[model samples]
Target: MREFVFALEYEPGCNRVADALADHPDARIRSLSLHATDDRLWRVDHATGTSAALEDIEGAFLNGDYYADCLATDDCGATQTTRVLDRTDDTLVLYSTWERTPTCASVPHIARDHLGDGVLFETRHEGRHYTWRIVHSGVGDPAAFFDALEAAVGDCARMEMLRAATTEADAPTGDGTGGASGLAPEQEAALRAAVEHGYYESPREVDVGDLADHLDVPRSTLTYRLRRAEERLAKGYVADERFADAPSTPL
Candidate 1:
């Protein structure tokens, strides 16, 4: 089977939810998933590092002209809505169903229409851009997929293929580095920068404010990015360890 990992950037004006989030200086969508069973059913997870009002995040969905209803909200500020998606102290799971219309132009709809069977592993609002990490399988011709995606999105500049390959090995195992390949570019960079800046030292040499300044981003943005990177790294480490402990097949 062939697997391709792509990082797609969309114009804010082209995607209502992304555009709305971009409008709020402090708001961001941490992670998002669009299930294969139904493109309408979506799972969106928010980052908790920002002090932005919950209403500010909710308003993006409510006014985006996409989601039909707000299903629920937790103490952590995570929300569940019909047309769009939230954060929690412990962790919240929110499910939403989307209705495709001529007016709706979400990235998931475009990918579903073009990439067919692709899995959206991550989505985030970074600065003014919305970056999506998607893994597409059974891709016989990646070039063809790119062509179709560009046609569907109406803007080639917003989309780009980050990595693609056909192989028997799982992603983290392929590079022999225990799944570090799964980390997004920004995430990896953030983690590396944190270590280099002594953020992980016993006596922290750099605070969030200093790191933010060094990264040339808001403190909230830096915090969210670091948190996400750390979580992914930890998960990758655990998966690698589990696989290593598994009984080996007889040669």
Candidate 2:
């Protein structure tokens, strides 16, 4: 098995992510390691027993405080947990370390494997600090792995840039002209609070059911409203003005 280790730095004054890690029933502390006076990281073990299914990790990262904690959502729901080392409140450093596990059969060479073509694979971010790696195995060429890695890295970089831009600005100034704003006046008032509540920043932490309760709307209705709001934001705000006048088409 090959191993790779890397570190992610968190901006300062954003440590409330630690609170998200509290009380997650499914949360597990795989392995913890300390590097220096201010650096500590964790290695999450994804392997699970047969009866208990593996849960998908939605988002994980160390906040500005440098400790690794992340929001996770499975097919069932979302939870956030801080997976930090004990006895240290210093800067959190999330690390990734891997080793190959024994399998019943010998691994086949990527070059020789015919199953490599026309195959699609999916990945899930495991531990905090957005530690991403292969979550599933399919027949493939090792060379193809490079393409996937590049795509993931690019996506991460883009997301980080967008997040930084949003943080610097005042809560986004929506004109409220769209009929799809879905949020009630009270909910709209609470919109800015959503980031602090871990909503806007982490979609995985959003509980549609809970949001519906707070908004006094049906869960489905809440979902439709949120979806429409997202659609408008993607099409109107995120897209360039050149595409603004284009009509929507069925995919």
In order, what lDDT does every prediction score?
0.54, 0.30
- Top model number, lDDT: 1
Instruction: For candidate 2, write residues 1-251 as lDDT tens digits.
Output: 11112212122222232122222323323323311111222243232211221221112343222222321111112122334222222223234422212211101112113223332221122122222222123334444544333342332221110010111133254432322443333333334334445566545476667766775754533443444345545675656665777888899
lDDT (Cα, 0-100) at 103 in candidate 1: 43
TM-score of 1: 0.53
**TM-scores of the models, in the order given:** 0.53, 0.21
Every model: Cα RMSD to truth:
8.1, 17.7
The superposed Cα distance between candidate 1 and the true structure at residue 29, in angstroms, equals 7.4
lDDT of 2: 0.30
Give Cα distance to truth, residue 60, candidate 2, Å: 43
